[model samples]
Target: MIWFYERRGEHLRCEIRQQLEGDQFALVVTMPDGSERVELFEDSRILNVRSVELEKLLRSKGWDGPFARDI
Candidate 1:
């Protein structure tokens, strides 16, 4: 998996790793060097997500937009 990083605040960071298996999307995230960890979102909520709007949500979450520019 590729490394995904985001600036949470002025100097905070959120790191993530993602992958897809079968019909589900697997996502894991950690903040402040694994201080607060979250993982295994079943992704059932994404069933009706449209690509265009998904991009917008990512931006709002401080994702830096995309892999190319963010990384």
Candidate 2:
């Protein structure tokens, strides 16, 4: 329920909330319209996802990656 992006044009605020599913991290995307979308990443898809690699992954999906939330 945190603001991930500022409202701009057609893009509303987006958020990346993490959920604990088994031993993996479930990244839940909360869209501007209050809709939720979950992205599942296989081990192969994230086994090497670190720093720059992870940033590229998120950027590929139109995300700005994780950032500090403003109070």
Candidate 3:
């Protein structure tokens, strides 16, 4: 799954997918500046929790989404 947030004409991306190397999942965040951060999780539950937390954090910081697609 993927989500996008926007602020001041910049975009932030968040994507979640299963990793090929193990029974793990990845939470990949692409910052507006173009740097990327990858986080691994043992299961979907934890990944989902973290995803929600991230969305809330970004919203509090004045970003605009959880958007299903880039705007």
lDDT (tens digit, per residue) of candidate 2 on 1-71: 43353333333343333445654444455666778766554452463343346445556767653455656
lDDT for each residue of candidate 3 in 1-71, tens digit (9 for 90 to 100): 88899999999999998989889999999999899999999978988899989989999999998789736
- What TM-score goes with each of the models? 0.32, 0.44, 0.92
Q: Which candidate, 2 or 3, has the higher TM-score?
A: 3
- Global Cα RMSD, each model: 5.8, 5.2, 1.6
Task: Tell me the tens digit of each residue's lDDT in model 1 across 11-52.
Answer: 223333344565554443334455554444446465224333
Overall lDDT per candidate, in order of appearance: 0.44, 0.48, 0.92
> Model 2 TM-score?
0.44
Model 2, residue 7: C-alpha shift (Å): 4.3
Q: Which candidate number would show the highest lDDT if scored against the true structure?
A: 3
Backbone clashes in model 3, listed as residue pairs: none
The superposed Cα distance between candidate 1 and the true structure at residue 48, in angstroms, equals: 11
